[model samples]
Target: MDGFSFFIYAFLSIFVIVSPLSGVVTFISLTSNMTLHEKNEIAKKAVILACIIAVFFAVLGNKLLGVFGINVDSLRIAGGILLFTIAFDMMHAKISAESITEEEINRSQEREDIWIFPIALPLLTGPGTISAVIVLMGTAPGFQEKIMILAAIVLTFAISLLMFLFSRRIHRFIGYNGMLVFTRLMGLFLAALAVDLVATGIKNIFPMLGKLV
Candidate 1:
């Protein structure tokens, strides 16, 4: 694909998997008692932190994999497993274990600033999305391609931040059940994508399965 097409592809892929809107209900619920300023501040902090974390993984992901003697195929399989698990949670409208835990949620209630805890750490920059970013970046064939991918990442996050800025309006418009339906649909698509990822990884690892491709 051309650079622009690749950028669009990457942007959409990350956005769908990340599903920033997926947490709209949770975000509105968490900050319902806070002032508008406070809500925006939290949104800003969370999005910025999440962006930083994602970029860090995107840039260093390949290096980390090499250092650990891991390969893209291995990453694909691992990421697929993680995404599948998260998909299950999404389908059930349950909090993902791979993201935040019950204990973390309980503990977060006592803290004043949750932007770093459940908000940024797992809400936005969770395991499923992080792994997806790394694997996606790893697929780039060149430095320029990687740069374009990173650009796409930045653009996706920017859109997410904007969505968060209007969280209240969005929540009200979509309502809880609407968001749930969207989340479940995304989860189903993510599950299928995860399976494809694993299948591709296995095919590459064991060329004997090439016929499956």
Candidate 2:
């Protein structure tokens, strides 16, 4: 794609792939015991951390992948599995063991911040989103397109931050049952996305499979 097409595609792709709605559910769940102030702080920290990671990966993704002999397809499958694991827990109304530990949940009640783990690393800037950013940025045809990729990352994070700001009002509107319902719905989407990721990665690995019945 040309620069503008790349930019538009990258922008929307980042937004949809990030799935900020799921982040809302996760943020609320993880910070359930925190006050509004704590939740707000966590949101800020998480978004900031996410921005850093996105930009860093966009700039250095190819080098990092080459250094590790890693490829995008592998990342897709790994990310898909991670997202699937998280989706399964969300579907069951529980925290994903891969994302959070029982000990962490117990300690969360007393701790000041838990933004770095589930919030920043895997939750916000997880594999799927990171892989998208890296591939999009790495494939950009020119400097302008690379900048556009960064802009897409910025835009996606801004959208996520907005959702987080209204999280309390959303929680009140949704209530406990509503949150569970929403989480389950989003979980289904994530699960489907995960399966697609795995399938796509496998197809790329073995292109003939795409033609098979």
* Candidate 1 structure quality by residue, lDDT tens digits, 84-119: 988899899876787776687777776778998888
Distance from true position, residue 1, model 2, in Å? 8.0
Task: Show where candidate 1 strays beyond 4 Å.
Answer: none
Which segments of candidate 2 are over 4 A away from where they belong?
1-19, 23-38, 135-149
In model 2, what are the clashing residue pairs, if there are any? none
- Candidate of highest TM-score: 1
Question: What would the per-residue lDDT of candidate 2 be over residues 1-213, giving only the tens digit for each residue?
Answer: 777787777886676556676567667777887788878889999889988998898899878988999887777777778778877887886656655556765666565657877678766787667777876765567889889999989998998888887887876787768867766876777688678878887888789998893
At residue 94, what lDDT does model 2 achieve?
68
As a whole number from 0 to 100, the lDDT of residue 41 in candidate 2 is 89
- Taking every candidate in turn, the Cα RMSD to the unseen true structure, in Å, is 1.6, 3.4
| lDDT values for all models | 0.84, 0.77
Query: Which ten-residue region of model 2 has the weakest summed lDDT?
Result: 95-104
